[model samples]
Target: MASSWDNRVAFVVRYLYDIDCNGYLDAHDFHCLALRSCVLEGKGECSKARLQKYQHIMLSLWEEIAQLADFDKDGIVTVDEFKQAVMNCCVGRRYEDFPQAMRAFIESNFRLIDLNNDGILALEEYRYDCVQRIVVEDIKIIDEAYYSLLNDDDRRRGGITLTRYQELFAQFLGDQSDDCPAKHLFGPLEL
Candidate 1:
């Protein structure tokens, strides 16, 4: 009974990971490789430092989505596993904390995580989801802060570059944006 339940539960979690996460067999599995490549690969060189920084961003993004994970087999919370943390977060269309198994997510997560039984999760796979999520989230937050003719028109025009995104933050969010740098929205990540 125990082994059967474990298998079933693990299967469902994998299903959910495929939907939201980069669809690795499991989110934890993805992190396992990302940590090694991004952090472990760093050395006493400029590239090494650059890689580590990217790793940090991936970790942060993972942390954000992980708030919705489910760990306990009882469909309840009792531990602090990353899976449990992820299931606890806000994801999906409405950002609602819907309590569903991993198998439930059938949305187009192909661009984010693919569940093709691929054994390894590359840096690109890991970072793309993180960066894209960060961009969308940042845009939402920015739009909430300001909606002037110039501000609203620029984003609509699509002429605004990533470099100018920082200026947008400084202009509207102002001091609230102080704690976070504009570069965080999107920057070249090599790891």
Candidate 2:
């Protein structure tokens, strides 16, 4: 059985990957996400190359998920499959290469979120580009989550860089302590 923290992590993964909210993850969902990432969400038009890059990254992520989670050998992954796979492959630390696989996904997502190409995710960018796209949580919660990832200096400077995001990402996945601020990385985990 999975722990509450593992369940929460699985919920977040399902929430993010199930683009259509269809209750299952499939190639079409990943394809839609890739397209959405390339669309002009107030970030201006994405180049053909960039679109292709996003497609490649999302599809690669899909492949990894399928390999790890698609236990039925079917093309789609159900909620149960997702939960079990997340426990085994992620929080369980069963796969040694999982971190490297996740790094690619994280880096790609950071680039997608870092509009303006400034290498830093500004507050507005995080609110508009990242959080708004994922969930309709309150502004205060969103702001708090974003600010929690930053140190005093980084907060004063404006936003989190990719390095900082990577660290927070690690903490969010690996840390099980109640005091971990990264637990709010995708808003409050309903654990």
Candidate 3:
């Protein structure tokens, strides 16, 4: 039985990874996410080689997730399976204890979001990368959420670097506290 916190985390994961909104995560969802990334990068901006790399990374991520979460050995992962995997692998674990697949997924996602490849996520980059993908009722809400991910120092620095994002990602997954700002990493939580 998953706690409400687990459910909330699962909701965030499904919101991001379930690209088709079909309630199950499959290879096609990852493929669509890769296509979205290419589109975000724009046609000629991504180049054929870069597009191939994105596709490969997304597919590999899907493979890793499926291996961990697809308990039925089916091609798709249900929200329940995702929640269970989260409970087993993330909750109560330190960031350093996370599985390689989880770390790879995080790094790959960060790379995909860093459109300029500058190793930092500026506000505009975060806005374009996140807002375009999430279906939010109010755009302002997303802006607020983005700001919440940054501390005063991070704001002063002008952007979040990959290291900051990694720490936040770990918090979002492993922290049991409701006050964690990383809970807003994707967007507002229903809880």
Point to the candidate with the largest TM-score.
Answer: 3
How much is 129 displaced in model 2, in angstroms?
4.0
lDDT of 2 by residue, 1-191 (tens): 23246655665666678888888999998898778777743366778887887788788888988988899998999988876776676652422336455567787778877778898888787777545545555787677767776788677767888877776766666656556656665554454
Off by over 4 Å in 2: 1-7, 40-46, 92-101, 130-138, 189-191
Q: On a 0 to 100 scale, what is the lDDT of residue 52 in model 2?
A: 88
Give the poorly placed runs of model 1, Cα more than 4 Å off: 1-46, 71-152, 155-191
lDDT of candidate 3 over 71-178, digit per residue (tens) = 999899888888787778888786677777567667877876788889888877777776665566777877887898899878887888888888888788887777
Candidate 3, superposed: residue stretches over 4 Å from native: 1-4, 42-46, 134-140
Model 2 TM: 0.79
What does candidate 1's lDDT look like per residue over 1-191, in tens digits?
21222222333334223333443333454344344434333422336565555445444444433444433333322223533443333211122233232212211122123222242222333344345323433444334322221234445553332224324323212222222332222221111
Clashes of 3: 0
State, as a TM-score between 0 and 1, how close model 3 is to the true structure.
0.80
lDDT of 2 at 164: 79
